[model samples]
Target chain A: MLEGELLGVFALTWQAAVMLGLGGLLIYLGIAKEVEPVLLVPIGTGVILANVPLGGLTEPGGLFAVLRAAGIDTELFPLLIFIGVGAMIDFGSLLERPYTVFLGAAAQFGIFGTFFLAYFLGDGGLRLFDFSFTDAISIGIIGSADGPTSIYVATMLGSKYTPAIVVAAYSYMALVPIIQPPIMRALTTEAERRLAMPTRAQRVSRRTRVLFPILSILVVGLIAPKATPLIGTLMFGNLLRESGVVERLSRAAQNEMANIVTILLGLTVGGMMTARDFLRPETIMIYVMGVVAFALGTAAGLMLGKVMYLASGRRINPLIGAAGISAFPMCARVVQRVGLEANPHNHLLMHAAGANTAGQIASVVAGGAALVLVPFFA
Target chain B: MAEHVVEAPAPGKILRVHVEEGKPVAAGDRLCVLEALKMELPMVAPVGGTVKALHMSPGQTVEAGDPLAVIEASP
Candidate 1:
């Protein structure tokens, strides 16, 4: 060993320095700005650890490598996260207003629309980026606004941009408050936003609550078998929560299981963000396209909301339509806030929640559809 | 007869109050409307009695143990 190469900081390259800075930025955003603290914190730590020269964190037989293989590559982590998500969500709103499912289905327009645009910019057309058909489909799923579905689909499709997709999905989810409001306001007039919806829905029976997960799994599985694993695990967790027979399991799934999987998933995603892999033109394009997909999804949901409003003789507030972006309670809160801004007494939370929860189911179906269609066309 | 109190079934805002002092109510009568998690749940009378006192009003926030109303048990 007569080499003069340094062992640590002296051996770090400019690329590693840049990645380290990016890692610091992520950590700052998480801690100071509170931008998705749960995810960004671990992701930042993973990025820093991976960028240290000779750390072997990402090398073969190393920690990051083993994590990637065990969780992401196998697509187990995302599915497990779904179980936790399912346990936490209460679908009573969606069950009360069954028709809101249409808005949810319509919001998926962004996924297909973005897929087409992404394909056109990549190998399918201009060759500006290296996006294959699978990459484009996985990228398009950012419109789902769901982190686990995006991770599950991207990992299953074997996209090289899994890290970018995951980051974009989580980042945009946090930005739902900022990104969705302008679009919602632009789509509806003052009168439309001020329109009040029924504050109370008929109380759902306990038996109906118990049956919902079972029925959802059956219906969704029958239509989209590829989505069965994603939908099945999600519903299974929901069943555990609603069944009232497994309180301990439900609590664990909601709290302990969810937290553990989130940490592992965030770290694995961040570990993939080494400079050589992440600092690329394609990554930029993916981020840009992700925003477009989210916007288009919101717009499509609004359009569907307008249609439903007109069909309902203007009883349905078009503001609730924006909640169909599948960003869960955040999107619902945005809709409610916008509604209150228009009319101080207008409480649109229940209606917005109906559409928001519907989007959750629809996005999963869209993910499943993409899984099936991409292979056929590619 | 001793007075029996009815507490909030869940933590939420009282959207509506359907009973008043001295109102005759049945065991299964809806006493008030509590909004929680976007669903409006009826806080019903657990036992038939005369409404003695109402502790909550519209738009009031209630906790699980917060007494909503008091009923004088029928003899």
Candidate 2:
């Protein structure tokens, strides 16, 4: 689909060989390296499928095309993916510590911050890596650390930068372990990391559990209409989980449906990685921008955590704020790991999870805000 | 009024429902108990409240942040 002269395999072009090697690397990373292997494996396979000399597999009405039409166009894939994500999420930590909601919002600076940078780099009103107003806005959302939101926004806005944005979102998500630590440490002292939040005494009623997803769906979805599908499917999964019924369907939503959609989504994403599309000066910039976006998000969250720490009279550990970057449980785990590293007695997982879940919701809001604001800037 | 949210202390099954619906209590009150990480973590109410409703019974597994109750604020 992307423009490029078909290469002859027997007499291979260097670009084809290089791309082939890169494709192999992605597969190796997925299979052996285990870096986001769930998504990477299919993405790698798709790269191999698309890049084989004269394969025409990614051609019109081809496998990739069908996947795109069936999976992405109906927006079913992103929504389905969210169901799995919703089941995977534990909102208890977040519900216990409500203040972390603000940390989540603070971390969304990446989306807005990247928008400004991309705009300044190009049209001021904005030009970025060949991105239009919507395209750049979508690309900036890759920084939000929420995969479904990133894909949904890109698809809805019809951004030409989907592949770039997708890769950026996933790659940055995987990099949470690597990217968050330095910023967290630089922002918080060992004493701050060692801060232990007084574990609260609280009990949630069973009725509240059942009502939560329903209320969240109605409240969040109604507030942001475009986000309804995303929040709706997400809450639908949560309701299945919390309702104590339909175990079979819940298992299917969490496992079978999720696994199938993941494979399709990953490969479809990789199909977009042709040399014509991928190997550009802008590609490097997109990666760079993605890294900056992630760094900025981590910084904002950690800084705010410091602010929370001061406000709570050191009851809140600043390290937990780093979890507000939308990487889900991974970022939360990183915060927990770092907190323990600071003090073996220090356990911030629950505190950090509050921020982490908040980040998830806030990132979705940030995506919606981008949809609203970028058009204005344009 | 500040809202109180009951967060899961550990990954576990809620073994007991200690608080009854519509019962008013103090800032510190046992709401439920979760068997998690080899300990019974008593989920307590952070603020004084009339227990509005119950979301779980004994033997329900819960993760962190599943709301167990909601109390309408008493002015």
Candidate 3:
């Protein structure tokens, strides 16, 4: 009785032990594998802290709970992070090739496709799992490949599986390098991959740069009002960046604010992952659906790329289509690498960056569309 | 001699300059490596020629259309 009262070891459940191990594994992946060490490391530490018996960090009014309430529940952290992301992004490439916006829109099919499958397997049809309308939408958002958008959507929808969804979103995003290459290789012929796009595109004017974020806000907000908050903050940051007069504010958003919020957001997300909540069949299914979402998104993008390739008389590298998944620079880098592998002379970086940035806007719109449409259907 | 000016394809930093002024190069031969958006882009010579002048150096930042090198077609 004394030992039980004094030692946390005596109170530790097998579930908690498993969570501790999982937390350790996340740390290992972050430190050793260098897979998004910035977020993963903080998340891992939070997981360990939350699972420690008697720590109560995740209990009512605890540190994790307070952070979660102030950040995740209020949906402030992800929104703030978007500001940072916008400041970091250079839409010059996208402006040079506005046609790539279709590629961005094409990739969003993954979100809807995964939603349909999740709904069919759950409350909508098979009744295999407890995924309700909102749960399915949250799960579908894992395909957004943008962590902030996934969190914002999942939280806005009030999905019970927010922790699982966020984990899957971040994990799969880091795995973009591994998941995309096989699909890209299988979909494109050697000749298609080797196609070289013109390196020089029309340079965007300073006026166009400054007008882009404002115009995007007006267009996207008018079309998807629900996404206004998400897109608003994002474009606001970009406006600061392109304004040329707000260098200090833009720098703050990109560096100091982004770093601080990332730490809080990562830790809160990890703290939410209690073993009882995370070790469920539905959680496993969410992970599976995440892979499906990414694959489907990649496939859809590639198909459009193929269409564009033929339309352009094979001048457009179909590989650039794969960058339309909103994973930002990572997807663009993958396109460049794969293009190089197929032909050393092919440089697809600028073209891929265009599609990749377009994907960023498209994914935000898709997230807004989901927020608006899911409730009407539910 | 027909002189051709090779320009930067995008805004980035020169990571390495593989050619020196007065050196000969073939079309498609690497001229320098540019780092942009966290990826390395290897800039290549557009025509076979003797390098007449270089406008870029390692670690220098360049904008799109900034001249990186000038090449004179081999007579």
On the 0 to 100 scale, the lDDT of residue A189 in model 2 is 88
Q: What does DockQ come to for candidate 3?
A: 0.47
Indicate the docking level reached by candidate 3. Answer: acceptable
Chain A TM per prediction: 0.98, 0.93, 0.98
Q: How high is the TM-score of chain B in model 1?
A: 0.91
Q: Write the per-residue lDDT of candidate 3 for residues A1-378, one digit (tens) a residue.
A: 788668999989999999999899999999999999998999998899999988889889899999999999999999999999999999999999999999999998889899999999999999999999889999999888999999999999889899989989999999999999999999999999988777678878999999999999999999999999999999999999999998999999999999999999999999999998999999999999999999999889999999999998888888999999999899999999999898776778889999999999999999999988876788
- lDDT-based ranking: 3, 1, 2
Candidate 2 CAPRI classification by DockQ: incorrect
Instruction: Candidate 3: list runs displaced more than 4 Å.
Output: B1-7, B26-29, B45-49, B70-75
Q: Pick the candidate with the highest lDDT.
A: 3
Q: Each candidate: what lDDT?
A: 0.87, 0.78, 0.92
Q: Which ten residues in a row have the lowest lDDT in candidate 3 chain A?
A: A341-350
Candidate 2: share of reference interface contacts reproduced: 0.07
* Ordered list by TM-score, greatest first: 3, 1, 2
Q: Report the lDDT tens digits of candidate 2 across residue range A1-378.
A: 334454345645677677778778878987897888887788888887877877777788788888888888777888899998777676766776678999999999988788678766755654544756666677678778988888898888887677778878887898889988988888888889887665553666668877888888788767766667777888788788778787787788889988988988998988877777787777777788888889888898998988988888878888888888888878888887787677644557677778989899888777766666555666
- What would the per-residue lDDT of candidate 1 be over residues A1-378, giving only the tens digit for each residue? 223245767778899999999889989999999999999999999999999988889999999999999998888999999999899888888888899888889889878889999999998999989999999999999999999999989888989998999898888899988888999988889889988675556678899999999999999999999899989989999999999999999999999999999999889889999999888899999999999989999999999999999999999988888888898878887886788678654667767788988999999999999988775798
Candidate 1: residue pairs that collide: none
TM-score of 2: 0.81
